[model samples]
Target: MTLATLALTWRHLPAAPPCPRPRVRTSEAVLLSVATLALLLGISQTTTWGWVDPRTLGLFAVGGLAMAGWVWLTLRHDEPLIDLRSAFRGAAAAPNITALLAGAGMYMGLTLLMVLVQVDTPSGWGLGQPVAVAGLMLVPYSAMSVLGSRISLWVGARISPGRVLPIGCALYLASTVQLALGHDHVWQALLSMALAGLGSGSTFATLPVLLVRAVPAGETSSALAFNQVLRYIGFSVGSAVGVTVLGLVSGPVPDEHGFVAAMAVNAGVWVLAIGVVVRAIAAR
Candidate 1:
């Protein structure tokens, strides 16, 4: 499946355009990578070591300081890794922020679904589905994501792309609520995942365009790349948080209550993203 998808996109992929050379700042790059690695390590281990553990705390501290230095260096450097200035100001800021939150919610909710369907029913809440069946249930989600992107593009002709974000997020919000209420049946879980895919597809498709429109043509690529970094970090954090939540609530096996709680939290995240997008749209 992955190979076929890559083959399909290969022909349509655009050739890389030439641009002026950037002065590489090796130290800054290393520092930023350190920050990212530290953050990932800290978050990923939270399920094993509690959040208050000294190692976790120290990792976060180091990552924070490193990130601060990286930001400071970027602001002063002649050729920075990311064009943070343009991204943080004006219309760019709204979409970037939305991407961060929406990415987090999307991953968190999806991860929870994976766990909810497969965990052993020791706690009397899980369906205890086999791994293969649980994974197969997500096929509908991937399908809908593709369809949602096409729908977003079609709607773009009539409605502003920025306006589509809240609508997508609302779909996600609806899915989370539905999952939280009932995910015992295979159909229910698949439906919730489909809705999630729809939201994620539209949200991801619109974010790059928004960044492109907000920044100078020369800076657009770097700006979008930076936004992608934000999304990746958000996804990592969400994955770690979801695992931590479920682990904390699990005994010999995970509980359905944990899944419910996690879904509810994600629903709130969707609401937050929707509110931010809507407010940004209204302000414009």
Candidate 2:
């Protein structure tokens, strides 16, 4: 079904029942953060290398099993920090889809753009830099993300999260436009990245607010964790699109021109995201 129809349907779902919010222990929160960060780093880096020997694979398997055991032991107890029930049935499914699409749009957008920057030749507009050097070019974008995150945190404190999500959708649209109109050179790309950063910070940080409002207090963590999982799914799909599927299309084959094409697809996704958010707001 179309996103508009889904949003309309979601708006009509019965309000969720209230449940007690378990207080978070500080130690659990700290350990959770550290473990999550470490896990993310490990997962995000695996694609960089080609393969692993049997010994390395054996180590990975053992480590993963150990981590799983730790998590299970932690959550299986009474007053467990992780609530699994809420995750399965929070807000209507529309917002979940929105989260996934937005996440995919952000990751694919960056990866394809980076491809564009390094595809330079006289025939195309790329800067023709090596991947190592191109990595340096993204520093500004990362810096801007930090600034945007801080700003989003402030803005979220004052505004409804529902509003922030639409703003993110709009900013992503703006980034899409800037990249589509490539005549402006490097500044335009940088602007797109900054705009992207703002959108990313706004939408991601506040998504749980919507999730929380829709679910029982007891389900808060569970609902939010599901949302988090979807975001990672988006990230994975985006990587495949940017790194694999886009290349199969006829063009410069991962060069600037190909990147332009890939970004155009991402732009379309952004437009759909905008529609999803708008329909949601209107349905309310």
Candidate 1 residue-wise lDDT, 90-186, digit = tens: 8898888888888889889888988878876745677679999888877988998898888887787688988887888898888889989987787
Give candidate 2 misplaced runs (Cα > 4 Å).
Answer: 1-92, 255-257
The number of the candidate with the highest TM-score is: 1
Q: What is the TM-score of candidate 2?
A: 0.64
Residue range 45-76, candidate 2, lDDT tens digits: 44453125454344456546555654665566
TM-score of 1: 0.89
User: Which pairs clash inside model 2?
Assistant: none
How many steric clashes between backbone atoms does each model show? Answer: 0, 0
